[model samples]
Target: MSTVLAAVGAVHPLAAATVNDNTPWVGPGMMGFLIVVVIGLVTWFLGKSMTKQLRKLDAGRAEQQEAEGEEEAEAAAPAPAHDPKLNGAH
Candidate 1:
């Protein structure tokens, strides 16, 4: 099995050479950290912009509903008649 693996490595230049048991794998370095930070900032700004747009849409819908309600109320009610006798104005 080991010989077969060694032969495979010899045949492929891109294959891993030898496994290191000395040090354990660690986290990303400065470049990777900066990339992650940039991605997070971009995501945060996009989310904020989306929230603002949603709030605007909600406000517009609320105003439209209020206007529709006023129209309905006006259509349902009848105008009152004026009486000068009740007002004591001969």
Candidate 2:
């Protein structure tokens, strides 16, 4: 174990590789820009579709609520009164 430790300690650290200053550094070119544009357009279309769907859902819910309100009103209204004479009750 001590011999292994000594051997490990004797090893020197490697130096980093050098880069050429003459070479130009290239970045993400036209392809990256096209990809971003496509993604943006797709996202915009999806958002529009989602908005349309949500509006439909909201309209349906409103109609359902209106129908329920009418039903409740009908249930709560008082019935027509009957005359005693009409039923032969004097």
Candidate 3:
């Protein structure tokens, strides 16, 4: 296995060897571009998801506030229950 690997490494040049030695920036530039594209996609998707969640939270909050308002209105109304012990009629 070691001999085979040595022969292969000695005979086959790397794919990059075909490019000009003076052109050092090409590989690094392509990697940077790919990184930026991936980051941009992630940021865009995250922003869209966050906005959707925020809208849902706002809607839920509004519904809760409306229900609380209705409960507050009920609290101010008079109670009409009559107890027999309080009226000395038991």
Candidate 4:
């Protein structure tokens, strides 16, 4: 059994080093910075797009309101003519 174990250990010597090696790993601060940067970029792009859409919607609404106002003014009935002599006739 000892000879068999020695033979296996000799065949794969770096396996033990790979498991025991403690190389410098990433810290929480770096991870947090990456996450914040990604989120901020996404928010900036989304805000720009949302503002553009809102402005377009406002412009369309304004145009529609102006057209409706013109239609209403055109459809309105004209006021009757006033006569100064009719005021004393009553």
Best by TM-score: 2
Error of 3 at 73 (Å): 0.7
Order of the predicted models by TM-score, top scorer first: 2, 1, 3, 4
Candidate 4 residue lDDT tens string, 1-90: 556656656789875555455897657787899999999999999999999999999999999999999989988968779987889764
Q: Model 2 off-target regions past 4 Å?
A: 1-15, 18-21, 82-90
lDDT by residue for model 1 over 1-90, one digit each (tens)? 777767777887455354423467778889899999999999999999999999999999999999999999999898889989999999
The whole-model lDDT of each prediction reads 0.85, 0.80, 0.81, 0.84
> lDDT per residue, candidate 3, 1-90, as tens digits?
556655655677552343324654656577899999999999999999999999999999999999999999899878878989899995
Question: Between the candidate structures 2 and 4, which one is better when assessed by lDDT?
Answer: 4
What is the Cα-based TM-score of model 1?
A: 0.61
Ranking by lDDT: 1, 4, 3, 2
- Model 3 residue 19 CA deviation (Å) reads 23
TM-score of every candidate: 0.61, 0.68, 0.57, 0.53
